[model samples]
Target: MNEVKASMAGSVWKIVAKEGEQVKSGEDVAILESMKMEIPIPSEADGTVKELKVAEGDFVNEGDVIAIIE
Candidate 1:
């Protein structure tokens, strides 16, 4: 399993995938809002989305695991 982590402190703006969903590397998995900017979080590897550690509007810190892929 691989952990998809947040790159910086931000609020989750959109969840582009859900549990059990298959994601490819470089595909946007979620969108985050930080410093008035919208950043897309991409999948680190091609795998099924095993879990989401945060939700929309949730605040996350840098290096925090945002999702698990397996």
Candidate 2:
């Protein structure tokens, strides 16, 4: 299993990958809004998205797990 972690502290702007969706390494799984900038959170592993830990409009800190891939 691999965990996709948030790169920065921000509110979740969008979730690009859904549960059970296939994803490749470096693919954007979610986008976060912080300091008026949009930051895309990428998956570090290639696999199916097993779960999403945060929802759109939810705030998360850096290093927070965004999703699980396996």
Candidate 3:
């Protein structure tokens, strides 16, 4: 299993994939808003969505696990 973590401190703007959804490498899995800009969070590997640690409007810090894949 792989844990997809936040790259920077930000608020979750949206959830693009649901649990159990199959995702491909480089696919946008979530969107984060920080510094007044919306940033796309892409998957580093292809896998099924295992868990989402946060939801829309949640705040996260860099290195915090946002989701898991396996």
Tell me the lDDT of model 3 at 58: 98
| Residue 24 lDDT, candidate 2, scale 0-100 | 98
**Lowest-sum lDDT 10-residue window in model 2:** 1-10
Task: Please give the lDDT score at residue 2 for candidate 2.
Answer: 98
Candidate 1 lDDT over residue span 1-70, tens digit each: 9898888999999999999999999888889999999999999899999999999999999988889999
Number of the top candidate by TM-score? 2
Please report how far candidate 3 places residue 28 from its true position, in Å.
1.0
Candidate 2 on 1-70: residue-level lDDT in tens?
9999988899999999999999999999999999999999999989999999999999999999999999
- Give me the candidate number with maximum lDDT: 2
Model 2 misplaced stretches (Cα beyond 4 Å): none
Please, what is the TM-score per model?
Answer: 0.96, 0.98, 0.96
Pairs clashing in candidate 2? none
- Candidate 3, residue 32: the lDDT equals 96
Give me the displacement of residue 12 in model 2, in angstroms.
Answer: 0.1
